[model samples]
Target chain A: MKFLDFFRSKRPSSASIAKERLQIIVSHERRRPSTPDFLPSLQKDILEVVRKYIQINENQIKLSVDRNGDCEVLELNISLSDPGKK
Target chain B: MKFLDFFRSKRPSSASIAKERLQIIVSHERRRPSTPDFLPSLQKDILEVVRKYIQINENQIKLSVDRNGDCEVLELNISLSDPGKK
Candidate 1:
């Protein structure tokens, strides 16, 4: 009990919690695909196209989905680095 | 129209297409975070731990989520390199 006593945690709002979980899981899946060997090429292609709009942080792009009955919602977390004093 | 005629496409059912979209979106979201500067340390920590269980493909780790009413489901694509013919 003493080990736990030092930390006080508050439950997060359902939306925030869901968003957080979504970000983490999407990161994991993107890095590990069904076919592992082909990922490097895929990454290169993605990065090349992605660089046009934004300088990707290379570590924060996560993609995922939610199935609502028959409709599927795609969730993308587009985190951008500091615009660098622009 | 001729350019379009060269391509033949079949409409994917809501399920298969959803999965494909989910994978791509998750990949994007994981790479972009609310806070970009903190991602390197996160990746390093995750990789160091993940190396022991499996040689993570590194390029495919997409972390994401699905919010079901009040519950958040974490979806992780755990892809591994060939088990090395063990």
Candidate 2:
């Protein structure tokens, strides 16, 4: 039984569960309607900066902010098109 | 050896890593300064609604939004004080 268990997938840990919950909650928090007016300009500026290096669609760039306690974190994710083609 | 391996602590799976990374990124994304202007009022309203049922601090209530593709999710978390205490 123990040997069989070894081959089986491991159960998720409490830490993993907490992480999943945090992610869902945080993602929801970022969608608030009160988003700053500067966000569009910031996104545009970042898009321009990234465009200089690679080809990507405006939709491929994502930016958001998150807060934990007193600390605020800025996040950016950019997806590039086919690298070989360029 | 297989039995011994089973007794050993399980290694974290890729899903766990993804969850951790997502949690950090999502938490960071939620801190944007552009938070809705009505959020405070909304929080206050929720606090009042919860207060009627249980005792809790303003900080104990949390709310956020998350978007996946075209779908937007609203999330709310509330922490209650001692349950037995009056």
Candidate 3:
């Protein structure tokens, strides 16, 4: 009976379950990336530079971040409105 | 003797080594980043513009040609080395 009681006591409790949930939440937050501080200024500056050459608004610029090996690649794509050329 | 033979067989064969070396050399020049003629001037212009604000080198900027479904995507990546810190 004591051995059976020992095995029952070894089972995870509500506290342990709550701790596990907390750990999962922490890990999930670690994996999810937050927006960078310079993102707004960088985007604004890039858009400004692009606008100098071609007429494009902030909405026209498409930005994407991709990973290659250990390096992170930030790609900025802008579509031009060329009337004569296809 | 079986254990000794097992340890001896752990070494890679010469043919496999040669194949690996060849694979590395061949793959080094494999993905030719063939791009448009205007790309050079565009990059130069963009870099010139970006240099006004950020002190970034040419290596920090990565340009790759990607094909997405039907349209060919031109990727431009500028690595901001942690804005506040060096």
Computed on alpha carbons, the lDDT of every model, listed in order, comes to 0.34, 0.33, 0.32
What global local distance difference test value does model 3 have? Answer: 0.32
Off by over 4 Å in 3: A1-36, A57-86, B1-39, B49-54, B66-72, B78-86
TM-score attained by model 3:
0.33
Interface RMSD for every prediction, one decimal?
15.9, 19.9, 22.6
Candidate 2 displacement at residue B29 in angstroms: 21
DockQ of 2: 0.06
Error of 1 at B33 (Å): 16
Better of 1 and 3 by lDDT: 1
Tens digits of per-residue lDDT for model 2, B1-86:
32223222232365532211111111211222332223234334434543443455546555565554222233345433242135
Sliding window of 10 residues with minimal summed lDDT for model 1 chain A: A1-10
- Residue B3, candidate 2: Cα error in Å is 38
Note each model's CA RMSD in angstroms: 17.5, 19.2, 21.8
lDDT minimum window of 10 residues, candidate 2 chain B: B19-28
Candidate 2 on A1-86: residue-level lDDT in tens? 32123222332355532211111111111222332223334334434543443455546555566554222334455432232124
Q: Per-residue CA lDDT of candidate 3, range A1-86, in tens?
A: 22122222333465432211000000000111331333335445645644444445545455654332222324354434231132
Q: What is the Cα-based lDDT of residue B73 in candidate 3?
A: 29
What would the per-residue lDDT of candidate 3 be over residues B1-86, giving only the tens digit for each residue?
22122222332365532211000000000112331233334445555654554456655655555432223323344544432133
TM-score of chain B of each: 0.34, 0.35, 0.41
